[model samples]
Target: MPPLRTAFDALARLRDARAFHPKGARVDGELTTLDAGPWPLPAGSAQVAARLSKGAGVPDGFRDVLGLAVRVPLETGPWDLTFSTIGSLTRILPFPARGWCDASYSSLAPYRVGGQLRWLLARAARDQPKVDASLRAARRLVRGGGFELVLSSATAIGVPQPIARLRLHTVCDDAGQPTFDPMLNHPPGVTLYPDWLTKARELAYAGSRAGRA
Candidate 1:
């Protein structure tokens, strides 16, 4: 039998879509460091590119796992952070949401930051429209300041530290967006944990790229 990546690649080619988060919309944003303590992201502010998508390619009006992938320019390279709507900081499990405004998103995996493990999470505000899967309603967050970025420890203990405010500025054209791969396009400050899982995702992403071409 073929390996998992080969099978996934075949399916992606057959469908002509991503292996996961196939339906996504790109957005440009700015990251403002809230008067918070130090974190992995750059100091002060930085320009960001984001993609909001639905897992399983579910249609609108239906609850589906949501994904948030953001890229920030760094001195080392581009830093890509991928997140999924999750239940809680402790669980690190996927949670389906009705809309972009009401979802709680987390890394769904562990990361090492400055030699310590951490998880990135976000909670959306209600001002945005509900049941709009396209995330167009959430654009208000960029100007109004509603999206909150937080960081939690690997143990899932203690309160999550506030990182920064991530605001979606405008929708970006698909032709201009960069291919985000958290596995490879990461800055020095963030490192995916567990050697085995990292290798697995690396292979999966490589296969996904092949199928797309």
Candidate 2:
């Protein structure tokens, strides 16, 4: 079977198994806001300008004015994943000169559960034809549109479902090449992980039935 097909099969089975939830604590992050109405260095020394003047760059300016931040923990697992309920984009003009894109992702935490979803997904790809077909479709979507494959994870709570939502904000140059816009590019998607508590409840029920037998 093709490599993409194998990967797709693993993801589907992992999703079906509902491996999102595990036992853990609720996850959260520091709060941040967007102050400047838009970008391109607005007019007067507005609140955003004041902050920017004292700072070196855009991300830094946002951190001061809007209280935005970068994901510090980098490679280690995330503290929590944010969910996106709504998303939108728009263009603004007539002043300091600029354009903007926006997106929001809510947040949640997944308890530390065994990587059952990961294991199942890996097993499914062994010889699944349907998985291959899905992979082909996904590849077409990525090429036709502009998308990059990041990573695919599984959860039990919203297993077989999507919980977190992500939004990307970019700044376009004269040539139309988009540069990174820290203010808007955050918590890329809405993510739903399984709830360990719920999983435990279900397990308890299953155990009770076995005892009766």
Candidate 3:
């Protein structure tokens, strides 16, 4: 188990420094279907709210980890699917930036796909761009009823394979706090990796939430 108190303390420091992504723009859409893919999600329409932001307060032109949070209505309850530009986690300080549109976002942890543990991956956008044009395009597609959110799986070696697509329908503002934690908000089929990094993140999120409260 992780030292929750220590993790919370670190999270408080990060918050105090304002070292994380602070500005997020929200959009409302619909999760139309989970196409023929690896994840075991049903194909149906569900309300969705998504938040897009650049991490570490980096300028739009610079390379930074783009953050995305997708909230979907599920039978169990409202599930928040959080993603970062990188497909995997790293211990190194100052995370590297992989282009947002072409970048692969993961649950930042692993999940059970095909009875084996794998990380959930999703393409941020279709094409690479320096600005937020891809996000604008996604918004347009959502309004036009043509946006599809595709998710994939990353292997132990960090290669991505197709999984499913969630069709976006409309756009609206998000109602919840901008911050997201995969350990607390993941869906039913998703699982976290059993490792120090995962535990640390769980603790950090708990601490951050406590600080906010």
Candidate 4:
């Protein structure tokens, strides 16, 4: 069988076995808009299904990963976007005390701006004396439309440029089991980089599926 098909089969078996929900404290949010930009994107709203959990199953309140799975309707069809707090572009994992608001998201293993990639990361508020202060500032930004989503180079550190902004309307009940396959569920113009990291991810996804199955 083809490698792609083999990977899909593994993911399918995992789904059938009901084994995809080991981590992530799921939450609900709204994808209000694309946040006006140069790129051509349909103006529509979609539900944001997200998961907040530690990257290494560490203790709560430690450095964690925020997973966002969005399915947006477009002229072509449904466009799905899957991103993580710790961007794949970066090799270093963020420190635990960095907090969620300070986390970042990226697309493509190698970062590039204006390349059909939507990256999100929070910048620390200047002059904040404490971590809590920064967290509060981040929270306020999200609440007040100050949180910006931009297309730019993915960095292990530094603020992401603003291309779009997300305002989380509410937190809904978790979806019992949610599965996201970038290979099967990406937007029309977006694609994974042809790189070893992408291949590794495919294998990891297949392995996770098989393990769950």
Candidate 5:
């Protein structure tokens, strides 16, 4: 759990360093869900895309950043993300179908199996140290499944300074009940690209650094 929290914090801090506008640029577009597409490789893997409304004036660099590649497991459902700009009247910008997001990076699951095994093993290990039963069950369960990455965002309202919240939910369809990526259980220590948290962290950090300098 602590490791996951640390990773989230690192990701958030990374985003903050990049500095993105919360209200984002003026982007008019429709939001819709999509299935994974081809040409990106691993053909048949699910994917989603957002098409901005014409003449919306999205930043080219931001768009390029957002267009970065991401990967998710096969069992998970389609990805959904929201976008908004700084000083925008709308509190929430649902990127339902339109991909107004400025920056993007691929979401990868490197420890799906190992993490699952460790979690399951922890439960039994608490009861007994040397047990073959737990090991057997862990092996069987972790052998066949994977995880998913769902992207979403929120606005950080109120004083102290207004900001937006960008969230990514990691899910696994092993038992049909989706478990949010354990990563989001707490406020990330750092922010990643295209994430609202990133922008806020940058502002806060800059102010602190300036005061010291």
Candidate 6:
């Protein structure tokens, strides 16, 4: 995986930002657990730090894949849930999104939650406004009321069930934002499965950190 790491490092250095989702806005948020599907998310609210970005960094007025990284301070540790707009459930490919509304997101890979493989998803809540694909819009959107998302968890052959509501609060500067990495910062019972995939993902993030740091 040395070549993969090197390639990611080069890409990050070339862009002068993250290897992927180079441009983004940071936001302070809160996650309210509602009849949760997993432990640690059962019956309480948690302070959340999040990043919203475009996967390809496409310019405004254009469609691009959207990304969201949410960090919740769990009792076990910080859990980062990163999501991206996916085209389909077959292979979980990345798809372009027009804006904040109607954009679908998924973790792309299953995680072992309570000894069962689960897919996490997020979508704009029904009472959302039309927020465009730009950093400024994200800032304005959050300041106004922010994006309310319906958190969902699904099994391999089952439908995604609504588990919680994640509400973004205020915009924050990126200067002090933590590099969200679930591979290293996940809680005790939540684990990324399929060893090879995790290793590759970890290496990519490591390279990004080294390049962007």
Number of the top-ranking candidate, with lDDT as the measure: 6
Q: How many steric clashes does model 4 contain?
A: 2
lDDT of model 3, residue 15? 67
Please report, in order, the local distance difference test score of every candidate based on alpha carbons: 0.71, 0.22, 0.59, 0.46, 0.24, 0.83
**Model 4, residue 204: what's the lDDT?**
65
The positional error of residue 165 in candidate 4, measured at the CA in angstroms, is 1.8
TM-scores across all candidates? 0.85, 0.18, 0.70, 0.58, 0.18, 0.93
List candidate 4 segments past 4 Å from native: 1-21, 34-40, 75-77, 86-97, 108-160
Report the number of the highest-TM-score candidate.
Answer: 6
**Candidate 3: where is the Cα deviation over 4 Å?**
1-19, 35-40, 87-99, 124-148, 157-159, 167-179, 187-189
* Model 1 misplacement above 4 A: 35-38, 89-91, 125-131, 135-155
lDDT (Cα, tens digit) per residue for candidate 6, span 1-213: 498888889899999999999988989888998867564673688888999988889888888888899998876778888998876544267788777766789888888877788888888899899878777777788889777999898888878888889999888874576788878888776777677888999999989888886
lDDT of 1 by residue, 1-213 (tens): 238679668767976978778877788878877543434567888888888888888776778888888897778888888888876434467888777767678887777765567777776543544446555444444445444444333335666666677777676554454678998888665667777878888878877777777
Could you give the candidate ranking by lDDT, starting with the highest? 6, 1, 3, 4, 5, 2
Candidate that beats the other on TM-score, 3 or 5, i.e. the better one: 3
After superposition of all CA atoms, the RMSD between model 3 and the true structure is: 4.7
Candidate 4 lDDT over 1-213, as tens digits, reads 446546655765655542232344444455545453533345655555544334444444444444444454556756555555554345234333355445455442542235543343433333322222133333443445333333233344565444444444333343564555665555555555545656766766676666465
Instruction: Specify the poorest-scoring 10-residue window by lDDT in model 5.
Output: 117-126
- lDDT string, candidate 3, 66-166, tens digits: 66677766666666776777633541223435444555666666666567777666663453233342445435545664445577766677557665655
Q: How accurate is candidate 3 locally (lDDT)?
A: 0.59
Task: List all candidate RMSDs to the true structure.
Answer: 3.0, 21.9, 4.7, 6.7, 21.5, 1.7
